[model samples]
Target: MGTLVSLGSFCLVRFAVRLLLLMFRGAEASTFTFVNKCGQTVWPGILSNAGSPALESTGFELPAASSRAFQPPTGWSGRFWARTGCSAAASGGAWSCATGDCGSGQVECNGAGAAPPATLAEFTLAPSSAGQDFYDVSLVDGYNLPMVVEASGTPGAGGSCAATGCVVDLNRMCPAELRVAEGGACRSACEAFGTPEFCCSGAYASPATCRPSTYSQMFKSACPKSYSYAFDDPTSTFTCAGGADYTITFCPGSAPSQKSSRDSSTSSTTTASSTYSGTGGGLTLEDDSWLASLATGDASHATTARGPVPFLYSFIAAMALAYTLLQ
Candidate 1:
């Protein structure tokens, strides 16, 4: 009788453990971590495997689990404007970033020829320019497609810009843009090769001037000064390489590419990085592995180890004691 009770207790305990495991399910998909070269996290623009990459949208979905994956050109250029300080009623959207104001902000949308502030997300296969006046770089449109990251300027209080007129700096705190001076001046960037200016009502902020052509032939002559990541040689900037488009995704400690400092005169690829920052805070991504480990895979042997089954043993002992007394 004693031996039978012991054996039954052991088997019952094992069954209970197995049942618990089945009820909880073993692991999950959160354990994996993926990186997108496209520079954006919402995958629809660059990572979606099913949608037409040539279309534009806010985000995308991954075809499968991947790590360090660049944003595949889905079509959206990964560019959107957040109205800066405008009430929803006034800006008509979240922020009037397209207009440059937050509330009651307005932009002087001149005729069809008015200039708009464009975010340089990627370059497409296009011809180069000879000067800084006008230039073009094919861009990756949403739907993972092609478009142009054109550059031009205007001379008005604020043409079609969100709030009158101003150029919003995208390259902030990254080692890249920091290589130049700050504030109302054409300190660094592809514009310096020409006349570092801001796109205000009549001239670029740096006193250089703005036009609506989109291409800056200024680099070839100014290539000696500052080169466009799209027009320059390979490894020009983080998102300026020649072949594929880059979508941006923000993650913790994931901003290794934020460095923008390089020596233009030396032409030496290896140069110290000058810290520069503009606005979109450094990329901070969530830990995917945390989710993945919980979804699948076997637990470590140490984890599977069974602790003393005190409750089970106690119950068995009680049963035995009752039997002895009754007998």
Candidate 2:
């Protein structure tokens, strides 16, 4: 049974990655710098698209007021989100996070994606066909921390570039029903309700049907440039003019002179309880060597899958497929 599950995962992931590449062709090579400016430490998780190769390290520790830089090969499309209140895994040297846990029970998520109700910074760089990079800070999954993506430097030739993200901390204003992780993160209405209206499933899957709700509007009001809903691409998705490299910062207000209204209000913060915690070092590394083997050519890494995907991706993918077909 485990073998069958792994086989299915391999096929599904491979198909998904291929479709992503075709959808975002002309992607260019780029380097990303993930910086942690939050007052507390966070474990950052990385997950590439199904067919895409994995990054150098799937997960790692980023202490408060620190940063790390890594390069994703051309055509890579995936997400980066922080996990807070992590404790080291008992046997694997892995860290389990209170929020944004990837279910790998390790620092490296391997090929696994993040759990929902976590702020996500997503990227699709250098889409060859469009000749641009598309990126956005998404609150559609919900919010845990403040974040922003800045693209500096000139665009190549005729390309254009700009910065876009939700620099405001939404947790302070998150609706009571949508609050999760003891208010450390905000859960999207869809995640909380799981109905057709909130999840945009079944009949509500189409863009025309799944219009923005009052809750999404609240998020938009707080961060106009960020994605408040799944179909907010027209307003939320930003192009980097010429596929420029980017700096993704947690707590954008931590930067000089960027303090937002949310940052200034009261300013008292609380730490949530975590099931696990771990410092950096002495952890078992998941076997991600398959990434390099598959990177050499256009081939799928068809090994036995390790675990079922975290529920977040499965839900999002289903909704996305419904939206596409209904549209």
Candidate 3:
């Protein structure tokens, strides 16, 4: 009887160990690291899909040259954007941002999403380790800043697993008609004209009908890898292997040495010299070795972003339960 009881206790402990491994594995599947390389502060806002659970923070302040990390569970889907020029209303009034405001009146966006004219990083993580994750940097709503999304993991079969983003500073060259004078954001043609064609609404909802407008063409010319219009899935969407972590960098790389231009009358293209004078002096768009270093676990920032406390606690608890059962 004693021997039988010992065997049963051992089996229970083994089962508990397996269960804890599965739980932690799911927790570590997706770690989002947001790096703010901009010269000014960036308040990043997150909005989870209807069926997804909220992360530890819906929004938070990320100062320049800093980064923050979050681990979302499997099957999570959400969109992320940065708010600029934020401040509190005098005398204990509502806090607000000049661009990409979630209108939650505070840093924590809660369930709110960013207002228009904000560059967005959208993601839908795989449900399991075997599935693929779909992600993209979208300017369909317009652009406020330069942003990039880089995935790090084992490449899945039939997946591109490439980095995609708008690294150029679009605000400097945005069409005068679409430029937001106060906040330096660039509005989409839909927001500027409010026409059904530009908005991809009414009769132009389908991909076949909603062709890219001249404005979207200009955006596409500048940021080819980004979503320039409503139906830009072909080039804008990117996929990675399951269990990959992503790093979203704002104001990535040095200022552009050249900018893209289009003449409406002649439909001609011209390139102009431009540069981004952000504070990220050591990083440049051309040199992506730093990103590769991150993937190989050579970057110091990558190690600091993930903590082992949760796993440690879980192991302790499981061992304690096993000990009690054995006794």
Who wins the lDDT comparison? 3
Q: What is the C-alpha lDDT of each candidate?
A: 0.24, 0.65, 0.75
Tens digits of per-residue lDDT for model 2, 262-321: 222222222222211122111111233322221121113311111232334655676486
Number of the predicted model whose TM-score against the real structure is largest = 3
Rank ordering of all candidates by TM-score, starting from the highest: 3, 2, 1
Models 1 onward score TM values of 0.23, 0.66, 0.77
Model 2, which residues run further than 4 Å from truth?
1-28, 89-94, 127-130, 153-160, 241-243, 254-327
Q: What does candidate 3's lDDT look like per residue over 254-319, in tens digits? A: 321111100111221112222345322223334555333332323232211222334567777887
Number of backbone collisions per candidate: 127, 18, 1
Give RMSD (Å) of candidate 2 vs. truth: 19.8
lDDT of 1 by residue, 203-233 (tens): 4432234432233332222221112333333
- Displacement of the residue 26 alpha carbon in candidate 1, Å: 29
